[model samples]
Target: MRGYVAMTAQEVAEFMASGLFDVSDVYAPTSQFIVDHQDLDDEEIEYTLSMVAAEDALEMKTATSGAACVLAFEVPAESISESHDMSISLSSPLKWESLECLFEVSSDGEELTWYATQEIDANLASWLK
Candidate 1:
């Protein structure tokens, strides 16, 4: 399953160094998500969910005083379990091996600029310093 994870820029740097990404909550396309977005196709639904997650991440950034970004990853279907609410939880930490892409959420919360896997390290280097 493809999922989105919100993290601070510092967190992104740490994950890059450790080669592991662990978060209790990840936003993914769950059964409830699909049911909620019956009008859209799979790809569109994923994008919509990602934007919502990005907004939450932006709030986290403000509360924590750090830069916020969203990560796109691919994990096994069995790894994800739905929560009572709209979000889902991962059975275990997702590894860098599953990473697919990254999104830098704009400060104004109006845009999400994508970063490919190969570009992430350099982007973090610039953002952190």
Candidate 2:
């Protein structure tokens, strides 16, 4: 995976939200996909549901091999003392040519770790020889 462009979770988030990342032909969901296959944790579900509610633009990362990118956001505090944050990680297989095959993971700020949630669209899956 060397020489593949790498970005931090914050960088990925900014790329998605700020439109710096090109999203042409990419799937930017207005809501989390309700698939029966994968089940997300509470924190992961919360992040996905938030995306459903917000209009922020989203983007996918490019991968060379086993590559991953992360998108993070700060959840509005329920109270002044509460600060909840979440991050979603997107992964792709070796030499992926497009956003297809991307999968998702979520992280709560407390542990700074990710939990698997969903598999992204595989529109380009057939493009492979």
Worst 10 residues of 1 by lDDT: 78-87
Compare the candidates by TM-score and give the number of the best one: 1
**Predicted candidate 1, C-alpha RMSD:** 2.1
* Residue 31 shift from truth in candidate 2, angstroms: 4.8
Model 1, range 29-129, lDDT digits (tens) per residue? 77787887789898898888789878877877854445778888897777776553456788888898899998988888788999999998777865554
TM values, all candidates: 0.88, 0.20
- For each candidate, what is the lDDT? 0.81, 0.28
lDDT of 2: 0.28
Q: What's the C-alpha lDDT at position 32 in model 2? A: 34
Clash number for every model? 0, 0
Best by lDDT: 1
